[model samples]
Target chain A: MTPKVSRFLRDAAPATPCLVVDVDRVAENYGRLKAAMPLARIYYAVKANPAAPILGRLVDMQSCFDAASLEEVRLCLDAGARPEDISFGNTVKKESAIQAAYAAGVRMFAFDSEPELRKLARSAPGAKVYCRILVGNVGAEWPLSKKFGCEVEMARDLMVMARDLGLDPYGISFHVGSQQTRTAAYEAAIARVAMLFTDLKDAGINLRMANLGGGYPVRYRAEVPEIDAFGAAIMGAMVEHFGNALPEILIEPGRFIVGDAGVLSAEVVLVSRKEQDDPVRWVYLDIGRFGGLAETEGEAIKYAFRTPHDGGAEGPVTIAGPTCDSTDTLYEKSNYRLPLALDCGDRVELLSTGAYVTTYASQGFNGFAPLAEHYI
Target chain B: MTPKVSRFLRDAAPATPCLVVDVDRVAENYGRLKAAMPLARIYYAVKANPAAPILGRLVDMQSCFDAASLEEVRLCLDAGARPEDISFGNTVKKESAIQAAYAAGVRMFAFDSEPELRKLARSAPGAKVYCRILVGNVGAEWPLSKKFGCEVEMARDLMVMARDLGLDPYGISFHVGSQQTRTAAYEAAIARVAMLFTDLKDAGINLRMANLGGGYPVRYRAEVPEIDAFGAAIMGAMVEHFGNALPEILIEPGRFIVGDAGVLSAEVVLVSRKEQDDPVRWVYLDIGRFGGLAETEGEAIKYAFRTPHDGGAEGPVTIAGPTCDSTDTLYEKSNYRLPLALDCGDRVELLSTGAYVTTYASQGFNGFAPLAEHYI
Candidate 1:
């Protein structure tokens, strides 16, 4: 936990299963990212944590936004972000959303298919549109599947068609994947996008932007390359691929900007064993999958935990959430270990949970209230 | 879709993505279950769908309740269910929740461990408690893992410990699984629990109740055995084990009570292919996993669809929700096929989604509003 969040937890003593975010840490991370990649414009991915405080802080920092839906676009606007500073980033959108965003003066949008392009042409006339191209996600923890982007050849045709349909063929974007650990993934995607930029230029569509979509890594239970390494690797790839004619660079980072800036405080409700002699204890927390530690699905995102008994004698544990459903069980195969002294009513903080915990929570699954959020 | 739901959808064209439930169908389901298992008391599982209308109608039928949390117990009480008619059924619960329910006149609870039993002893004092045991979950679509229950020996010990702590060791309980497809699954679990029932009786605890927890399946893309099969198998096992001195039988049916009583109608947001000639089309809808089709996490619980062009020429397809996250992609490997004529803005209904849909929804992931609900 950041010092501010630690102080808040110590002083305020909020209820269990609540997230406390340090807004100052968010600003610091934003500054560090800006320092690492000065040439690229940052568009805070609002889907990560769209709490008003986070949005207002990013808006005050003059950071742009990447909105996944029309409601998110309005959230940014409500936070005093200019419509031009917000990009409608989702490729699959309702035509009504497109018309609404266009009327709201949001000119920039993203699309990948002919139908979506047609919707854009009809709804948001002459809007600057970026085509999301499919990229390999070999090294990412949460590899985003082929749900959003189109094949490279299809994107090439779509960009050409964009200009024909009277929309500005603004750019090409690709996501290596979310929580991408390997810089080589970004480099590979950048090379593929550069070749596409050349192909589009030869086809008489002068694209002026390249959106390297969000996949920046955050430290959880393991180490990841620093933001400086990603910065250097990305710039090196750009220089190698495009020489001095690099297009305007854009990075839509949801996880990186605020991922490590908050901590989720939960209480241990029960600590027991399935068998009397079983070595491993089952630790049940007050919150669960439905309460929004959703990244724990399949034990994909291994979040580090800090218990009140940290540094004491430890033993292997199988962690689960408080819901009655079996799917709410987390960290069974991952071999989680907690301090031996950890018991019911003891507070534990899950570190680096700032990004995706709040909005991902269910309305009130199993009649448990939604996870609360506090921004200090 | 049921004729009632179909008529409501056509006559009162609500928003694109909303759940329209036929409360009359819920009443009919209650009657059917009563007919199928006349010897067993039906405790309506409120976690499935705790809407006021469903609860009120079930209350009218003189149904008891199996609540997963204190808020659910309160929901039952608010719906005119007496506290004596409700069971705090979750094995894992907070002491505060137990105290709250006890204060609110709840007397029965479930536990699988000594620690939880101790909490009940302290918070609920003389409350009657049931111990849940681990049982194999074969032939279950959503196999509830070994997260909630305990070993037979452990449950036996925990019940004794409950009696020692001044609480009533009322009975034993076990869940075969959710969406359980086979009658044999219940028979196998009954055999396991029956042996323990004899063991506990020899130990001087005359437990009076047996909770066969909910797992009843609903027909989705495939058919399941009729409720009569489960009822017969369960009765046969009980009679074979207990002879002439059968205990009071209780079965919690969540999905069976309401799963087929509702329909979720969503608008197709976009329909496209990764490649121009690709055979599989990716159909995006306004509702997705985060929007409460969470049963599709591992492509389990395959819900049937009703499209406007249902009988038209069909082609292979993958379905996804409107959220921008790749995890929002619902069905990719389930061999889902939709009509070739299905296109953007077309409305489709997912049938048998009455249970576990509304409350499981996120707090508006990706800025899309939560799936609306209407009961007629």
Candidate 2:
């Protein structure tokens, strides 16, 4: 099915199989996040595709980083982020990784247990420790609550221990889960985590800020809860819990700020037929499971496949990536309307793949290069 | 759940996250396949994983290759395979890729469309064509018959055209599907495609083989069909259909021959306490999404987490890969009976990942190194 008309076609557009980022939209997203939580310091989660140019733009927007690894910390630093602006969000602290972060001048760190605290104390003794408490329950849909973060009682113990050991327990943190759709889940977690601050205060440990660990759902597909609503709910919950006594809020939003602004565009080099009830069209494109994992992690990102000109006709096609594996499929059911019949050497754009589009999934299969990023 | 007392003490071994292929077993598998298919030529699907060593081993075993791309053709050549031994199995051909394959002297090609036939006619006019037909109604669970082949009616037309144009339509091919569990599907498809050979001979365009394409299931988990039974059923069906007049038989056995023979091995770098669940041992191993996509596809590859030495008590734990994405999981519900308590810097091994294990779904996220492949 073709689009009624094509308004986006340009003769000079580079070939497909490239990652395109809407610079204006990403910057606007950054500004929106800042405006929503004006008092909160934002850390761009580099764990989502940490493309240098994208990180550079985030740096330009005055965003800090929530880095999960030493390499992520280095990536932000390479993109001109100050080491002091990055928080090592990964709670599992290996001595070398912590040492690398410390060497990179990263001041803030997250600790989920006494063992991690001991590692930090032994290695980067002066690093600012943020007690990562296991905050909310993300039910069976995604049970990320099972990963890292200390329980409330254990968090209180660690906070008390940190204060007693003359270590800086500057903040408290909680990551609800990634790709979170429910704003209520976030609000409840915020209210629950805020209580930990009051408990620590009762124990005479004054915390500086509450790191509401990221999971601001990006508009991957469907009506993603508005970032403003999430920010307001968390901010409202913080005010209701502690009023003026609340610490400065710090939020880490990775996917929300970047996910929808990116598009992976590739050309169909060959269209093969498969045996089915109908002759299924196998549109062979450059991007596959490795390049666009968001597609495989269904519901994480919504995939809309379009040819360069929407003015083409539509069909039911199974988009196969270039990888030879039969499982390497981008979309099982793609219903699209384009300007003309798409044949070999036609480009298709996969929308809303910005945040986690690139950085990690570069498999050099077929000697096909990784998508060279282009900022529009 | 620790495996019962065995020499492979969950930890006191090479490491966890290591792909340890029992070379002897893989060799036995090769021997078994050769024994089972006395008349059929085994075309090892190199697209499963183009590891040079693995290719070399197959070459040593006199296995022909089902090359999907120019690079795979080159890999096979580099592994010491002769040019004539490789079949360019991909039906959708790019001009450059076609030129490369021709230059590399790939003689057997699978053709699906008239346009593809024209390309072959112009580029490599003398090459033998395999009239690729879709296994329509072949009740294989994955029925690839939907994507890469032509309708029987269209295949008949192509065969007539090829003969008229002096092209050698030497055989008919139909891939039931990859990891196919049903033997009846292969039998039915064989019966159908074999009729095409007879039809061609009746028309005086005699062809030699009817390829029952690769769909032989590989053991990912314990629930897969018995290979011996499957091979026997396929042989039985071939005899039942084309018996005395049966030309040559060709089967592309990619996963079955190599899948269980390989294991993706890596080591645990960090272990963290998850919020609500058990300790999520963040085994930051060297392997990633690229090594093999079986884990993501929900294929039944058994994962066994082990270490170098008996360190502590044995228990089941969740294994997370080094990739930053929340979906980067190896075994979702595997019970690794660690002989000792596994901590940071411990190793874990994923068992039976030989086929499509290396570079098939690699995402070099966070700069995690590729799974280092080793041979026994």
The alpha-carbon interface RMSD of model 2 comes to 3.7
Q: Tell how far residue B320 is off in model 1, in angstroms.
A: 0.4
Assess every candidate by TM-score.
Answer: 0.99, 0.84
Per-residue lDDT, model 2, residue A266, is 77
lDDT string, candidate 1, A246-279, tens digits: 8999999989989999899999999999999999
lDDT of 2 by residue, A274-364 (tens): 3324544667676776555544544334466666556546656666676655555666653523343677777777767776667545455
Task: Report per-prediction Cα RMSD to one decimal.
Answer: 0.8, 5.0
Which one wins on lDDT?
1
- Put down candidate 1 lDDT per residue, B64-117, tens digits, no spaces: 999999999999999999999999999888899999999999999999888899
Tens digits of per-residue lDDT, candidate 2, B81-119, equal 999999988776676777778888888888887767777
How well does candidate 2 score on lDDT at residue A254?
Answer: 79
Q: Chain B of model 1: TM-score? A: 0.99
DockQ of 1: 0.90
